[model samples]
Target: MINKKDIKTLIVKKPLTLDCGRVISDFPIAYETYGKLNERKDNAILIFHALTGDQFVTGKNPVTDKDGWWAYAVGSGKAINTDKYFLICANVIGGCMGSFGPSHIDPETKKAFGTKFPVITINDMVNAQVNLLDHFKINQLFSVIGGSMGGMQVLQFVSNFPDKAKTAIPIACTSSHSAQNIAFNELGRQSIMADSDWKEGNYQNQNLNPGKGLSVARMAAHITYLSKKGLENKFGRKLQERDDLKFGFDADFQIESYLRHQGSVFVDRFDANSYLYITRAMDYFDLPRKFGGNLSKAFEKTKTKFFIISFTSDWLYPTQENKDIVIALNSIGADVGFAEIESDKGHDSFLLDVPDFLNVLKNFVDKSYEELIR
Candidate 1:
């Protein structure tokens, strides 16, 4: 079992009020760092992880023994080159990766928080993570970057602290969660809740693993991360093991087996209740609504350079939604750049090894660094 002691964390002693009107302090924000912080501290980049991602962004996760989630795009000489930049990624407060979450014991009852854990929002996540800046003594970050829910955190981070970052990159995400997004997330949550092993989110106390339900949730959500064309190109109608149909529901197709493997492995590393909490946070994200229904207002008084990206095939957070952010920034006469890269991969294009994306991202960050410092 992965324990909190295995991960590095920052214990936040100062109380932080959440959007849900709860105050929490002395909680932990689990994190990992790469590269060295420069004397000026301007090279620091705060990276935010997507829904299931942890603080392990660019190296082998000590706990999972698996490649870090952003291994392809980050590392010594990759796009977000650690050779020239210092990177810090925090496991969001609602995460399971040794961060403050439902799995942690509540001092009052001396039991796991479970469903009693207060509901968090995208705003709450960024608010808690911003403590990292103070902890690291960084007055301003060189950039704030993330994709999907991470991207939402990036938006909230910049909005909440306009002057804290010099540049902001929100990729393959939306300022507002759509109804379709909520529906898909709800499906995953319901699948988990439906499992008897879930035990009403108190399964941790009972020592019953809600693996089946969490696996199903992961499987359902995984489908939304891929595109129709990408799925067809990769799996199509290929058989898993035997070409002949067994007629039973035993994963006859390659896609079924692939999804099953994805789901099963996910439960080994993730907590079921954390999944529920994080999805609710994602579903509640509405940046424009928070800013008086004018997304442009979210960028007011911020000189942070903005570079937004989207994948043409990402129906989950479509290019149009990304364009909406660009349109809003443009309306406010904010300095902004936008790109919609062509890819067969869906919302997951940002995470995969897309050369076009890697190059574009590298060029933007590097060029911005040089120009800013000059």
Candidate 2:
């Protein structure tokens, strides 16, 4: 069980109006910090978490007792190098981890808000997070960075607060969620809702955990994170435990077993309602469309240095979508740099230990710091 007291929180007394025209105040924003903030405070980097990620960015997650999601890329002497920078990661509003979400008891009804939680947008998410800057007294961040949904937050952050970050990195993500991506998210949502145990998202009140439904949703979404080549190379036609196909739809292949494990473990850490809400927020994201169909205009006012990354095998966001961001920044003459990394790890590549990705990222931050000091 996650002990809420173990998590750090900021209760924003300021009311926030959501995209759905709902106003919430005094809500908790759970976060974790790493390293020490120097006297200059300019060494701070605010990292946004992806859909399934929490405030745990590096080291051991207190709640899960597992390696943080970006453990391979962050820490002392790693890419982000906490030894030389202050890192802050916050659980997004609609997240399960000690943050304000549907799982929280509604003050009015004294029951879990469940689906009654106001629908949030990527815009609302970033706006709420910007309060962290005020909390930390950081005038400007050294950089704002993240991958996938996190990457979308990076873009929205820069667009919403043009002068708040010195540099930005949006990795393996799209400015707008693609139709295919929306369809995939919908499949996950439907899988969860289809389970009878869900009880219209009120399972918590009835002591019923819709684990089966949530597990299937996770299994479906997990497949989208990997490439066909990656899956074949890793799991192939290998049998799970038997040599022959005594298969009656019973874990015949290693791939099936692997996916089952992923789904099972995911349900232990995630909430079903959160999965639905966050994916909906992602599906609703369309930065270009929000800015009157001109992507360039979104960043026209910001001078933040951009370093966008995309993997060769990431069909979810794809190299083209990442490049579209680059093209838009370039059209307005924004300081932007891009790299199309050669990898078969699909959309999940950015979270893994890809040497080329790590090296370029490290150099950019270190060199950018040198430039900042100079």
Candidate 3:
């Protein structure tokens, strides 16, 4: 179990600029640190979390008394290897996990920002992270590593601050949100708002939550996180807890029971309004938009080495997305390597116990470290 008493929260009391031409000030960033920061501070690894992730990257969660989400990749001898590298993970802006988000109080109305929170882009999330880094006096990072939405932020960091990181690893991600992706996100948003209890995003004041709506949304989205083969292999037509199906509103299938459990646990740890804000931020992410819609133009000035990894079964952001990032990087002569791991775990493969991917990461980070020193 991780020590909760020592868990500290740092706040940046200033407004920030957003991609939508809006300002967010007096913001507070919540973060957690593991391992000691060496004198040089270059031993630091900045980790960006995905849509529903918090700063509890490793160690047990204080709130729920559960294991950390990514403990598999971030222990003493793990891939992130806490013994050697100082690790930092912060709850991103617009996140529900201790960071300023829709749940945070708005200075203007002194109420929760709710739907009034400005829409943020991946660049904006990176900018908020920059503030957190400044607070910690980390001028540069040894590496920036992330998966899924976190990967989007990683790309944003390398593009915006080319000199800040020596290496970047963006796993199971796209350079930008595709139109189809946006539509899927919108459906989730609509499901949340459609709940009568949502009360135009003011559900917090009434102490009511759109639990059913949020669960439905989660259930729908979680399906995209896996491949058809994975789902089939894991659950298929297996019956749940009964020899024969009742066939009437019962969780007759194993998959249905699993999904219900996912939704229930997710609602406990996450806020509904935050779900809206973060998803919207993800939908607006477009790396090439900053450079006249030319994807290659985005990496023209960067010297950062990139290791882009994708899972063969991850339809959410398939191997093609990784290829596009590599092609663009190559267009500008950027140092880049791409790998597509064969796995049935789909988009969640990176977070799972995959020896092959872990070995690749170990080698990649080690090589980058050697190159930087030489």
Return the top candidate by lDDT.
Answer: 1
Please give the range of 10 consecutive residues that has the lowest summed lDDT in model 1.
Answer: 1-10
Q: Estimate the overall C-alpha local distance difference test score of candidate 1.
A: 0.94
Instruction: Give one digit per residue, the lDDT tens place, for model 1 in 92-195.
Output: 98889988999999999999999999999999999999999998899999999999999999999988999999999999999999999999999999999999
> Which prediction has more favorable lDDT, 1 or 3?
1
- Tens digits of per-residue lDDT for model 2 on 81-187? 99999999999999999889999999999999988899999998998899999999999999999999999999999999999999999999999998899999999
Which window of 10 residues has the lowest lDDT sum in candidate 3? 1-10
Residues 38-63 of candidate 3 have per-residue lDDT tens digits of: 88887888999998888888888786
- The TM-scores, one per candidate, come to 0.99, 0.99, 0.96
Clashes of 1: 0
Query: What is the C-alpha local distance difference test score of each model?
Result: 0.94, 0.93, 0.85
The collision pairs in model 3 are: 14-26, 15-24, 15-25, 16-24
Question: What lDDT score goes with residue 337 in model 2?
Answer: 96
Name the regions of candidate 3 deviating beyond 4 angstroms.
1-7
